[model samples]
Structures are given as C-alpha cells and as structure tokens.
Target: METIHLTYPETPDVVPSVMVLGFFDGVHTGHQAVIRHAQEQAERLNVPVTVVTFDPHPKQVLSNKPDAVRYITPLSRKLKRIESLGVERCLVLTFTKELAGLSPQQFVDDYLIGAGAVHVTAGFDYSYGKFGEGTMETMPFHARGRFTTSVVNEQTEGGEKVSSTRIRKLLGAGEVDAAATLLGSPYVICGEVIHGDARGRTIGYPTANVVMDASYVMPRLGVYATRVRLRDGRTFHAMTNVGRRPTFYDTGDVSIESHLFDFSEDLYGQLIEIEWVRFIRNERAFDGLDSLIAQLKQDETTARSILS
Candidate 1:
C-alpha cells in the first residue's frame, strides 16, 4: 500500500476516493469495521480505499504530563496493520499545533475537500477540530455536497466496547487472551534487537534483547510465551521476560529480553517482531545467580510445554 506522510503542502492527488479517518491505534476490530465499511464503499464507487490517520497521537502532543504518552501501536506497526486490511493508500497527517488548531469547517474544507474525498468513514464517537469541537452532528453540514459520511458504531465483544485503551489495559495486566479477542489477533511488539548485559548467555541461554519504540505500549512485567519473527521472516517459539533484573541489582529499569528456543545466533541490531501468546509468571527477585539460573531453567520448561 502507498504511504503518504502529509504536511500542509502535500495534498492527495486522487480526485475521488473513499476515505476512513481516525487514529487507528492497534487497528483493533472496531477500527477494522470502519476500514471495511470504507472499502465496501470504495468498491461500490469504483475508487481506491484511503486511510487517514495522525502521527504522534494527539494526546501525546496535547498532554503536559509524561505518563500520558502511551500508544497501542507505534507508527510502523500501525502502517503494517492498516496495509494488512487491504487499504490502497495511507495518508499520515503530521499532527502539528497548526493542524490541531483547525476549526471543524476548516478541517473538512482543507483536508476532505482538498484531498478529493468522495466518501468518508469514521467511528461513531469520532471527533475532530480544535479541542475536539467537531462531532458527527456537525460533520455532515461541513461536508455538504462535497462528500458523503458514514459513521460506524462501536464493535463489542462480551458486551463491552472494543477500544485501544481497553486493549492496552488488558495487555498491561497480562491478559493476552482477552486482549487478543478485542484486537482480532495477538498483541505484537516489533523492534530492533539491541545489546544487553549477556546475563542470559552466561546461563547457556543467550537471548535477544528487543528494544521497542518509545511510543509502543509495553505489556506487564512478566514471563510470557511468545512467537518471534526474525528479519529474514523465520518464526520461532520463545519465552520473553519484561522486567528489571531485581536479583542482580535494583536499578529498576524495565527491559524486554527473549530467549528463542533451539536458536543461537547473534541478533544484535536485527529487526524482529514478538507476538505475545500467554503470560506465564510475574517477575520476581531471586536470591543469587544460582537461584536465578534455576528459576530460568524451570521457566524454560514451562514455556516450552506451553508452546508445545
């Protein structure tokens, strides 16, 4: 799929296409429904399906506190997920202070009309404009004859709404199964493998330390059963730990370390994706190196059995 990182100057050249607009974090089931609706509309109109999303999530840009900057899928993963939905093109609007200041009418006039959107789709609760002044109530008026709008209702599972925030909370609590049901797939973290202290290597289980992007939401601190995909597209069963090495010292910095079973190769600087399947055990401090090694052996056995 084509990706366009849009600023004010780069307007879409396409004259008439069905467009879906949202942050689309996680590209969860609800976001998929909106995209699917847009795709069907595109099919009927004989036009390409375009997904319009924002970068550096609006909350992160607007918030004052550091902890407010959490995201379900980073930009790269977000693009990949959108592509997987069969979108013909993705327009990533760089969310700037000026863009955020656009009024409800100005946004439609500048983005929708300027970009040549024949039809637009969004979720039921979607809002836009400065301080979220725009709503479904006001969008159609702004569109007028220039475009048609479709608002998809929220997707629900187990009588609850499927949302990025809910999914993040679930994953943070080590509820992988629950999160998967809402996400329509396993929660995945894609990152580049970086150097570590070689703690796993000394124990005869050298690991790949996955350094995730800052925007990606990390799962709970625990040992998990996961599937690792290498840059060359090979998949392997793995056990991943997300925590600080409390036993060794109390630095308290969290890390994601993965031991790919039956695999031994230098993965430093390699890009990899890890798909969390299940949570096995919470992170804890062991007495010493011997105790930690013993626990790791037990963890390997449990992880292998679970994956098997």
Candidate 2:
C-alpha cells in the first residue's frame, strides 16, 4: 500500500480512485464495512481503493475536553490496518486549522476531486466542511457531477453499531473481550520498557515498567491477562497491572507493569507490545508486602487460566 501524507493545497498525481473517507480511528468494524464497500466499488470501477483519513483526531483539534484525548489505534497503527485491508493508497490529511476551514464544497472540490476520486464511500453519519455541515446526504450534492458516492448505513455487531467510541468505552470499562469482538483483534499497547523502583522484584515478581503512548486509550486501572511481545519476536503470557503503587506509600501516578511468565532478561529501554486479553481484578492497596505477594500469586494463577 502507498501512503501519502497530504502536504496541503497540492494534490498528488493519481489514477481515478474509489475513495473511502473517514477518521477511521481504530478502524473498527463499522469503518471496515465502509472501506470494504469501497473495495467492492473499486473492483467494479477498475480503480484503486484509496483511503482519505485525518490525523490527531478532529476532537483534539476542534474541541476542549476535561481529559486528554485518546486513540484506539494511533496513526501508524491505523495506516497499517488500512493497508492490511487491501487498500492500494492512503492520503492522510493533517487536520490543521486551515484544512478544518474548508467548506463542504471546497472539500469535495479539493480533496475528493483533487485526489482523482471517481467514486467515494463513507459512513452514513460522515460529515465534512466547516462545522461539519457537509453530510453523507449532502455529499452527492457537493460532488457536482464529478463523482459518485456510496453511504454505508450503520454497521452493527450484536445488534449495536460498531464504532471507535464503542471500542473506547469497552477498553475504558475493561471489557476487552467484548472490545476484541468489535475490533476483530486484541487491542495492543506499544511502549518502551523503563526502569521502575524495582518494587515487584523485591516481591519476587519483577515486572517491566512499560512507558506506553499517553495519547492512546488504556483499559481500566486493574490487573489483566496480557501477552507481551518483544522486539526479538519472543512472546509470553503475562500478568499486567495498571495502577499507582498505593501499598508502597508512593505517589499517585498510574503505571503499567507486566510480569512475564518464565522470563527474565534485561528489558530496560527495550520496545515491546502488550496485547490485552481480559480484565482480572481491580487494583488495590494491600496492608503489607506479604499480602501483596499473596494476591500477586493469585493473580498470576487467574491470569494463567485466562491466558492459557
């Protein structure tokens, strides 16, 4: 697949494309349906299936929120997933203030027409232009005889719409097993292994302190069964904890620590990925070190049962 980070005003040279348009965060099931529909259109039109997407999330750019915005799949991961879906080309637009100011007609004229889009596919609720006045219904009106449009009606899983928001909620609620159903795979957390206070080691369950993407949605603060994959392609079942160390009488900063089963190697500074499997239990402060160790042993047993 070819990736073109649109450098604004100038459109790339291209063949007539069957374009799939959306933010497509997580590329969750509904987004897949839209792209898949575009793929079908591309086959019929004998054109490449191209994706028109945006980065940094429009919400982060356009609105103020109480908390930091999070992504289900960051841009790099999103593009890879798009490529895996058999898309031939992807134009990732930077959601700058200038781009956000484009009128519905201008977006249709510049991005759609400029990209040589002969046919376009998007979700029924997709909107464009300044303040999102351009909607799927209005998209054809903006096409102005230049292209055809296809609006994929809501795609559902278990009778509910499959969406990035739904996935985020699932992860936030620690419902990873259900989230995977909508995502078609386990959610991954990529990070660097960093040094900790070596608290787990002293308790005989040394863990890798993973510094993950702060902009990505994290599962609820708890212990979960996960698989840790190393850069060297090694993978192991693991018990991961996401919480502050209250028992150690420490600060309240959240942390991600994973104890790999039967694994011991210097991992500081190593990049790794964690695939969340299932939520185990809520994190809590134990009365003493011995109690903490006892609970960790139980957690490992429970995690192994789920992971194995």
Candidate 3:
C-alpha cells in the first residue's frame, strides 16, 4: 500500500479514487466494515480504494483536555492495519487549528475534490469540517456531482455499537478479551524492552520491562496473561503487570513488566509486543519478597493454562 502525509491545501494528483475517511483509532471491526464496503465499491468502479486519515487526532487540537487523549493504534500501527485491509493508498492530513477552522465546503473541496476522489465511503456517523459540521447527509451537497458517497451503517456486537470508545472502555476495565472480539484481534501494547531496577531478578522472576509510548492506551492496572512477540520473530506465553509497585515504593509512574515463560536470555534494548489475553489479579502489595514470589508462581500457573 502507498501512504502519503499531506496538509490542507495540498492533495494528490492521481486517477480519481474511491476514498474512505475516518480517524480510525483502533481500526476496529466497524472500521473494517467501512473499508471493506469501500473496497467493494472501488472494484465496481474499477478504481483503487484509498483512505483519508487524520493525525494528531482532531480532538488533540480541538479538545479542552487534549492531553488526556490516548490511542488503541498509534499512527504507525494504524497504517499497518489500514494496509492489511487492502487499501491501495492512504492520505494522512495533519490536524491543525487552521485546518480545524476550515468550513465544511472548504474541507470537502480541499481534501476530496482536490484529491480526485470519484467515490467516497465512510461510517454513518463520520463527520468533518469546522466543528465537525460535515455529515453523510451533507456530503453529497458538498460534493456537487464531483463524487458519489456511500455510508456503512453502524456495526453492532452484543446489541451495542462497536466503537473505539467502547474498546477503550474495555481496555480501561481490563476486559481485553472482550475488546478483542470487537477489534477482530487482541488488544496489544507495543514497546521496547528496557532496563529496569532489576528488582524482578532479585525476586527470581526476572521480568522484561517494556518502554511504551506515552500516547498508547493502557489496560487496567493488574497482572494479566499475555503473549509476547519479539522483533526477531519469536513468540512466547507470558504474564504481565501494569501498576506502580506499591510494595517496593510508589513513584506513581506505571510500569509494564512481563515474564515470558521458559525464556532465559538477555533482552535489554530489544523491542516486543504484548497481546493481552486475560486479566489475572489486581496489583497489590505483599508482605515481602517471599510472598511476592509465591504470588508470581501462582500467576505463572494460571497464565500458562490460559495461554496453553
């Protein structure tokens, strides 16, 4: 897939394409449905399916609590997910105050008309333009014969709409397995294994400490059964904890530490991804190292059963 990053006032010059537009945070099942529908339309039109995504999140620039934003799939992962859906081209427009101030027509003209979009597909609720005033109902009026529009109705699971917000709620509550059902894949934490205080080694568990990006959504603070995939193309059953180590000392910074079962080689500075399988227990302080070790042993057994 070909990906391009562009700002307002600049659009690609190519054959008119079928475009799907959204922030696509998780690229969850609902998002996939929209893209698939676009692909179908693209095939019928004999045009490639293209995607238009926003960066820095519109909320990041528009929200009062911009700092509170976290993402299920960061830009890098989002691109991978989008490409996996067979989108032939991706146009990423950076969100800025100037862009946010664009009137609905200005946005449509600059992004859609300028990009040579012959057909567009998006979710029923997708909106754009200043204050997000653009909607599927309004898109046709804005297109003015320049393009046709398609709307993918809301996709539901368990009688509720599948959305990135709902997925984030599941992760926040440590319902990762539930989140995966909606996401069509496991909820993953991507980061690099970094140096730690070496405390787990002293306790004999010897965990790998992952250094994750600050903008990624985190699962609830607890021990979890996980599967670890190494950058070198290896995977292992693992267990993880996400919390401030109250038993040791509280700096208030959350730690992501995982112990890969049957692993014994050095891993400092290596990159890995952890897929949350199930929550095990809340992070709690134990009496001392002995109690911590015993609890970890139990966690390992439970994790093994789940990963098995």
lDDT for 206 in candidate 2 is: 97
What is the C-alpha lDDT profile of model 3 across 1-308, one tens digit per residue? 98889876666766589999999999999999999999999999999988999999877888899988999999999999999888899999988999889999988888888888999889999998888899999999999899999899999999999999999999999999999999999988789888899988877889999999548999999999999998888999999999998899856799899999999999888878999999999999988888888999999999999999
Best by TM-score: 3
All candidates in order of lDDT, best leading: 3, 2, 1
Which is superior by lDDT, 1 or 2? 2
What does candidate 2's lDDT look like per residue over 213-303, in tens digits? 5478989999999999999999999999999878875677888999999998999999899999999999888899889989999999999
lDDT score of residue 162 within candidate 2: 94
Name the best candidate (by lDDT): 3
**TM-score leaderboard ranking:** 3, 2, 1
lDDT (C-alpha, whole model) for all candidates: 0.88, 0.89, 0.91
Enumerate residue pairs that collide in model 2.
none
Candidate 1 collision pairs: none
How much RMSD separates candidate 3 from the native structure? 1.1
lDDT of 1 by residue, 195-278 (tens): 888978988878898888556788999999899999899999999999997887678788899999999888899989999988
Residue-pair clash count for candidate 2: 0
TM-score of 2: 0.96
